[model samples]
Target: MNRNIFIANRLREVLLNGHWIANTNYKEQLSDISWQQAIQQINELNTIAALTYHINYYLRGLLTAFETGKLEISDKYSFDLPEITCKDDWDKLIQDFVKNAACFIEKIEQLDVEVFEKPFFDEKYGSYLRNIEGVIEHSYYHLGQIVLIKELIAQ
Candidate 1:
């Protein structure tokens, strides 16, 4: 299998369609929750909505870099999610997240295998493969948090 295709599939597993890794993707986990439930706080952990926004933040930023050849994202602002007060707001965020995740996967699928070994945007950040895998691992980390938070909120 093409490396790009494999990587894209792995991303899809977490973000959109596949369920082998966690038995639930972001879309599945998020699809049924209400805005109120999304924002429910539990013992100082991030709300589901906030974690969703955080992952989407990286996806959108990386998509921009893939399209425009500029890497402008900062870790400091990755979690700076705006307020989601109503269902419209939460729905819009989810919609944006879905769109960005799809776009991000497409960008990965389009990359040349050689590009994966090249420095992402700067040598300081390491290779494109490093960053892409980082996103996957980082997403899973937060996805676990989201699942646990949902369980806590239910209890």
Candidate 2:
């Protein structure tokens, strides 16, 4: 196999694994326990919903900026975001979030790896590669929190 293709495959693999890990840590339920139950007994210091939603928000922002050359604001998709009512809404949001995240990885793959060294945008942490990896690391950190919170909710 060509070396470039090999690297491309590995890069795709990394994105897939990252997505898998993120999802594994938080199963989207169509019949989740009530929100009150989800955070019951949990301190306000811990963000019961913010952690997951923020990762999705950031990934969407980064990918949209890179692909469209337009920087994104946090609430850009507020209108489309799912409501915090039922489990179905939660599931839909997760699906949309994952779809957008995959699109981000695909766009990154379309760029020359050299582009990774370029600024992701005009933001403070503008380096493309760092932003990409930062999202992954950030997702992983929040994913861990989500898993722990879910376990607490279950208990």
Candidate 3:
């Protein structure tokens, strides 16, 4: 398989499986959680919803670059957090997350594998592929945190 295709597929799987860990059962694992459970300020630092937003935010940018062939680096990392304070808002967030995630992967799927080796001078990682790998690692890192927070909330 081509490098970009492989990376894109893995990124999709990462979001599909490792994105959420609020107080949800297996049946609704991807799209089930109370508003309070989502917004609960776990560990005095971040809410579950906040972390989820952060994950999606970075992944969105990563995939955007692949599709557009432009390295759109952010001037500032300024996402507050995911806040589904009401049922309607929660449902919208869920829908948007699913839709945007698929769209993001589609973007990544369209990229040329040769671009992966191309260097992005402004980005710390030196190459586009490294930056993308950072995106995946960042998601998994927080995913672990989300899982731990869910376990704590369940206790």
Candidate 3 local accuracy as lDDT? 0.65
For lDDT, candidate 1 versus 2, the one ahead is 1
Q: Which candidate model has the greater TM-score, 2 or 3?
A: 3
Off by over 4 Å in 2: 1-41, 45-48, 74-82
What is the per-residue lDDT of model 1 for residues 32-73, given as tens digits with 9 covering 90 to 100?
899999999887899999999999999999988888888998
Best by TM-score: 1
Backbone clashes counted, model 2: 0
lDDT of candidate 2 over 28-81, digit per residue (tens): 421254555433446654544455466667767767676688876555553343
lDDT of 1: 0.92
Candidate 2: residue 145 Cα off by (Å):
0.3
Worst 10 residues of 3 by lDDT: 18-27
Between candidates 1 and 2, the TM-score winner: 1
Encode model 3's per-residue lDDT on 9-34: one tens digit a residue. 66675676433333332113436567
The 10-residue segment with the lowest total lDDT in model 1: 61-70
TM-score of each: 0.98, 0.68, 0.77
Worst 10 residues of 2 by lDDT: 22-31
